[model samples]
Target: MSDRQRLLTVAFYLAKFNDEAVRNLGYVNFREAFNELGAKLDYSPNSVKNRRDDFDPLFGHRAGWHQIELSKSNLEIVEAFDHLSEEALRAIVFDLLDESSSKQGVLLADIVQGRQAPSYTTRGVTGKKAEAFFINWFQDHFPQDNLIDTRDFGCGYDFGVIGSNEVYEVKGLSGIDGGVLFTDKEWKVAAELQDEYHLVLVKDCFGEEPTVEIYSNPHEKFSPKKQVSTTININWGISVSEFNELDKE
Candidate 1:
């Protein structure tokens, strides 16, 4: 709520915009994210250069993000960071095997020159809550009492049932707009592995009536309805039943 904080918040938003743009443009490996941030922030091009040796003293080896310096006429500012707390930021870079898999992890160089790390919380609704949520979700739809058969620990499918004669590939639709997506592997695997590959999309998790649809024969050739709610349209350009049999017993 302070002047510095307000300015920093806008800077981070622009940083996220720049990073996401870089990823989407298929220049996923480039430094476009940082460059875009500098451009949007109106930082001098020459001042945007980063030096690793500068952070070694203060942040220690934990400082993994490239540090870019911003030079103005009299104001020589060398700081950058995102809206995330530092505890959240470090776990992404050092903890995760390949940082890209981390949803919490991001290109950290955008963090301003002198923001301190936030204190760590020993207890949070992060790990166990996540596992518990998944368990409840699976049980709700494919309850043990109702299921024909269920197996754990590297079961061949995400979920399999004998009575349904289907292989279910369930995915979280919480992030995307009330719609879902299937990877090329999931699409092909679903088609060839079983007679019917049910892409059971779970949306509006706690909302009044959760929407559930069965996508049968989800082949890559079969483009399902992607009723993405963009600026205008409300539903998909394609439908589930176009290629797959829907809600079959």
Candidate 2:
């Protein structure tokens, strides 16, 4: 899809959520939301509003362009995403808006293949939100300390405290109590760091009032069992002979 079409589709989904979208996106009003999103996507505010209007008819939140049939692209977007619940669609729209999200590629690929995109698990979205909350909380609570984001580096921790021998691994739980997983690398790193490694757990992360608990040297404090799992990857390829035969055809 053209970039404009993609942006329009995202805007349409956002519109379906109406006030909830504005609040979740931290916009005080719809006009501001449209302006900011339009600026981010390099489109005019009016275009965003129009896209929202295209979807408003189906949702009945506002009087939109309902006199005529939806454009083919708009109709296609509706058909693809209309069945999703608000939370599910919000996750997808958020992913699509984020240029750096790898999930965007998977979702778009599935859409192009005429397949239903896999539903995003609540845990996945909640983890991201919790991480964001922790980043902000860390900045506010520890102004003297500097945190280097190591999440993308896969360094067995999410943040490394500069000028200190400390690293922090973050975990999020939607409710007060839930299980957390650690990869082999994280476990090894925690064992090595011992006193310096920290586990920052955010509880009720998806709720209005989230709470945080920090465990220093979690490797020593808690005894977690080791569970092993295996995954297999499959790839399909044509042999040279088969390729040659096809070429001859």
Candidate 3:
């Protein structure tokens, strides 16, 4: 299948899982088999019986999810359905479905292949994936708080909360030992925000479920720090273990 079709299929399946009618069932039948569900176990049968009604609208009433399995290279990527909002995913899928190059899409384009590239850098991709994980986590755990993605704002913070004064700067690493880099502007912003600034460090971003550690007003915690360079290599750095101690939880 084409990449467009594959992405759309994933998106549709995600939406179908969210559909209320399908969710009313205990489980859904993908290949003529019943699967145990976590939240809506009783709705499995209903989902199968009302399959057509569920998907009639294309995207159904968003519902609880149990699991979603997709193939990634030689491995199958299996994750629990946990998104409260599929808007980003839907938008990405729709953009891919559109054949017009004039339109800007979520996934970045590769210069050589002229196709959507997952990410430009390995670190960048890891950080993005981790951000998505945190977004889901916040939406699920802190339903009262509205989290906004502000990474594109170049405001030294990756996310912000609506109706709140808090801001978050996220640093993601594939392992627990990686160093966190902060630009001069980001350091200035962190110092300015002080207590309102949150430094979120995610470890093992691409492994299973990523681990999150948050530090409030992290600028105050760094001690015996030194600037290695002022010209091209100017930046503040810290080890993941040192940052983990600041975790509120």
lDDT of each: 0.37, 0.72, 0.51
* Global CA lDDT computed for model 3: 0.51
Identify the runs in model 3 with alpha carbons over 4 angstroms from their true place: 1-125, 224-249
The prediction achieving the highest lDDT against the true structure is 2
* C-alpha RMSD for every candidate: 20.7, 14.5, 19.0
Model 1: lowest-lDDT 10 consecutive positions: 119-128
At residue 101, give the lDDT of candidate 2. 80
List candidate 2 segments past 4 Å from native.
1-123, 246-249
Answer with 1 or 3, whichever has the higher lDDT.
Answer: 3
Ranking by lDDT: 2, 3, 1
Model 3 C-alpha lDDT per residue in residues 11-124, reported as the tens digit of each score: 344444555323333235432222332111233534433432322232324322211112231011011112323444444433444557323332222211222222112233
Model 2 local distance difference test score: 0.72
Each prediction's number of clashing residue pairs:
15, 0, 8
Clashes of 2: 0
- Candidate with more favorable, higher lDDT: 1 or 2: 2
Residue by residue across 1-249, what tens digits does model 2's lDDT show? 456656766677776889998888778998898898898778898889888887775666876754334555564565566667766666666776677886654655456434232222122335566788899899999999999889989789889988998899888776677667677899889999998999999987757888999999988898887654222122357799998999999
Deviation in Å, model 1, residue 215 alpha carbon: 1.7
